[model samples]
Target: MKPVDDDVLLTEVQFKELFRDQSAIERYMSGPHPLVLGHRVIRDNRFLVKISPDNLTAFKKEYPHDPIVDLLTTPYWFRVHVYYDIVTSEDFVVLTHGKPGISDLPVVRIHSESLFNRFPLRTVGNRTSSRSR
Candidate 1:
């Protein structure tokens, strides 16, 4: 493998074409946003969304939390899922609030994506997952 010295840059048009998704790009380009944890959303928006079966399996593998406890305690009504993206290292959750249209046209909360801030130096107990950062 050769170590290249020059920076590999792409034009705006090239960048946009390569990455088809625009919402994420627009979200960051638009403005600042808040950072919320999956546990907090589950705790706060308990009635809003329910854990999808597929997500439950994945979540159980990643995080050390009992969703059943949250359900038993708070009691969610609708079916939704908390998704974790390993590539971006972000949690993409949908809180429908038991509404019909929300699941289809979700209200997205956007935030600045920062790898440095995402993986902070903290105790293992406080960390979200055992996966390498």
Candidate 2:
């Protein structure tokens, strides 16, 4: 897969649509394998995002000991699995090893949608919403 450029910022609508379907999230979390190799995050102007290995290296050279790099360089194999536990009223996010039968890591559950896809669609549809069905 082509690397996502750091310049991209996901919009609110795009984020919501991706996570709009609770079932889809459940499927992603409980299906046979749902480990995500990479993820996208929003950063301010001071923060530089790099996807290419070479770019990342260059960035590290310029900003030695940058915490953002540490966050960006997290291992892709570390899986953050999302599941809806019937016992709980809301969804949960869990981090686990990509391999099966591995122990799970601490999880941080956030109630938000992916902004990239949701935002652009909104912008595009704003003009056409009334004209189209």
Q: Cα RMSD (Å) per model?
A: 22.4, 19.1
Q: After TM-score superposition, what is the CA distance of residue 89 in candidate 2 from its true location, in Å?
A: 29
List candidate 2 stretches off by more than 4 Å.
1-50, 76-133
Give all TM-scores, in the order shown.
0.23, 0.22
lDDT of 2 by residue, 6-123 (tens): 3312233433444465564353234333322233444211112233354455557776774433434443344556666456344555654323323322222345542223335546
Q: Give one digit per residue, the lDDT tens place, for model 1 in 1-133.
A: 1112211122233334533465633432332321111211222222222223444344456553633313223432445666778896666655543443432433344544433336666675555453553
Q: Model 1: runs farther than 4 Å from truth?
A: 1-80, 99-133
Q: What is candidate 2's CA lDDT for residue 51?
A: 32
**Candidate 2 Cα lDDT to native:** 0.39
Error of 2 at 38 (Å): 13
